[model samples]
Structures are given as C-alpha cells and as structure tokens.
Target: MPKTYYGKYGIEVRTNEHNHKGQKAHVHVYIHGVEVGAFFLDGQLMVGNVKRKDRIAIEQLILSNRDEFQAMWDEFQKSAY
Candidate 1:
C-alpha cells in the first residue's frame, strides 16, 4: 500500500494508504497502528472502524491531503480522467 501525507494537528498528522479490493481507490487512516477509517479521493465517508470525532478529524485531514490522495490514485490507476 502506498502511503500519503494527510494532515497535521499540533504534532499529529493524519496519514493513510491504499488497501483491500472491491472498493474504489482510497486510503485507510491510522493513528499509531490502529485502523481508524477510510475515505475516497472524491471526499466521501468510508471509515471502517473509527469514531465520530475521528471521522471529523479525517475530513479535515482529507482537505489537506486531497492532492496527495488524488496523486496516489492517478498513479495507482494510471488512468486519465
């Protein structure tokens, strides 16, 4: 899974990577080693095992990492849109 620069909250920055199949191109976020949730490059909710606060934080993280996430998708999919 390719990782990406998500966001920074104080000293904490949300980061994620691509995982699984049967799903669209997206990233899974984690703090330390625990799985929080997932979100699509189109900015949709896809969190697997996260809380509401984490979901909110993930949204903010998405805005900041949107480009990186998109870049990852473009590179991974290798398709033009």
Candidate 2:
C-alpha cells in the first residue's frame, strides 16, 4: 500500500487492484490508526463513518494533494500486473 500521513489522518492506496469493481479512484482513510472509510479522489466518502468537520478537512486535504494521490493510485493499479 502507498500511504501519506497528514497530522492525525493517514490516507492509503490499497494494492488490491482486481477488487475495484465499478469503483472510482479512491483512498482508504485512517484516523489515529482506525479505519474511517474510503474516499474518492474528489473527496466523497464511499463508505464508513467520518464526522462532518473531519470530512471537510479530509476533503480539503485530498483536493490539495489530488495530483500526487492520483499518481500513487495509478501506480498501484499498474503494479497489480
């Protein structure tokens, strides 16, 4: 998994590329080591629980780092082969 940490939040791109059926580009979000949910590159939560404020913050963070995160996700997909 490729991961990036920001303060108390950890965002990761999981390596299970074959499991992404109908799913868009996303990252799994962890807060304080607990899995919160998976979020699309656009900052929409796919599944799991996240407080509104935290979700907003995460959205901003994702938007700010969208390019880098997207690149990591793309690389992970390629590595599935």
Q: Summarize candidate 2's per-residue lDDT along 1-81 as a digit string, tens digits.
A: 667899999998776554464457888899988889989999898899999999999999899999988887767766644
Deviation in Å, model 1, residue 57 alpha carbon: 0.9
| Per-candidate TM-score against the hidden true structure | 0.60, 0.87
Per-prediction CA RMSD (Å): 6.0, 1.8
Best by lDDT: 2
**Candidate 2 accuracy as lDDT:** 0.84
Please report how far candidate 2 places residue 55 from its true position, in Å. 0.3
